[model samples]
Target: MFFQAGASMVENQNADAILLAGTDLGLAFDGHDPGYRVIDALALHVAALTDLATSGRG
Candidate 1:
């Protein structure tokens, strides 16, 4: 499976974390465990935007 391959790559490369920036990539690692730390770039962007939009709210 892709997850296994990814996990293997992570282990091989000794990556601290994986960046899932693309929508499809995000979909691939969203609910499944990939045996490593994964950062959803889209989620972080959305969170930042949401916080900015709501920052002025009372």
Candidate 2:
């Protein structure tokens, strides 16, 4: 997963944008996964990149 994330980040020209995937488990399961947090962080990075691009900073 980390490798994939790195690849994606590299492909984006090392931009600060990221993508995340979220899932919901059954009632018997209720916990957060580290992967999810990683994804969230990536997403934030991506968003910042987008903002920069739109602002002509990229």
**TM-score top scorer:** 1
Residue 23 displacement (Å), model 1:
1.5
- Mark the regions of model 1 whose C-alpha exceeds 4 Å error after superposition: none
Which digits, one per residue and each the tens of the lDDT, describe model 2 over residues 1-58?
5446545665666645433443321111234332222345444567899999899868
Winner by lDDT: 1
lDDT of each: 0.80, 0.48
Q: Give Cα distance to truth, residue 53, candidate 1, Å.
A: 0.3
TM-score, model 1 to reference: 0.78
Candidate 2: clashing pairs of residues? 16-45, 16-46, 17-45, 17-46, 18-42, 18-43, 18-46
Worst 10 residues of 2 by lDDT: 21-30
Tell me the deviation in Å of residue 35 in model 2.
15
